[model samples]
Target: MICPFCGAAMEKGCIKGQHEMAWLPDDKRDALFTDAHLQEGAVLLASSSIFKGSVVDAWCCRVCEKLVVEY
Candidate 1:
């Protein structure tokens, strides 16, 4: 996808390292989701039974650091 902010192309691939997110007390370890106001947004896609587990990928813009996800 194209980055709307910087007008640069986005790189398509799975995130290299383990990416963790949380909605509880803000800490250095977890990504704060209070701004999103959604609980359980960040989940283990592989073990999740709610949604059909499938190939998941993430894309990021090299210029603006905007990220997009595909599953």
Candidate 2:
């Protein structure tokens, strides 16, 4: 993918996490969330779990040090 920040080429990759992965709002207190109680605007990269990693597709731009992911 092409980076939107610096007009550079981006590398396709995965965002891995031992637990859940998400982009949460700054004002939010805890990262934990259930499917029924998911916060607004929270982009969940991976679901919460134990002993298993979560992998999400992402694009990284080395030039701008930016990462883009889709939920």
Candidate 3:
């Protein structure tokens, strides 16, 4: 993929996490949890089980130091 910001060649990769991974709107708070529970309206990217974690396909632009992901 080509980076939309800089027209640079993007690299294919996967985003991984041990526990949970998600994308939230910029207006939302950084806290993903409230009183030990998950907040609403989070776009879950990957979730983990007892044995393994899930991965989401993504493209990274090293030139712009940006990452693009689809859930």
lDDT of each: 0.52, 0.76, 0.76
Relative to the true structure, candidate 1 reaches a TM of 0.43
Q: What's the lDDT for residue 19 in model 2?
A: 68
lDDT for each residue of candidate 2 in 6-71, tens digit (9 for 90 to 100):
999999998887767767678664644454127777777777567667888899999989999977
Of candidates 2 and 1, the better by lDDT: 2
- CA error at residue 38 for candidate 1, angstroms: 12
Candidates sorted by TM-score, best first: 3, 2, 1
lDDT of 3 by residue, 4-44 (tens): 99999999999876666766666665664442125566677
> Per-residue alpha-carbon lDDT of model 1 for 1-71, expressed as tens digits?
88777889988886432333222434332544442224444334322223443345778897888877653
Clashes of each: 0, 0, 0
Candidate 2, residue 7: the lDDT equals 95
Q: List the residue pairs that clash in candidate 2.
A: none
lDDT of 2 at 50: 70
State, as a TM-score between 0 and 1, how close model 2 is to the true structure.
0.74
Higher-ranked by TM-score: 1 or 2: 2
Best by TM-score: 3
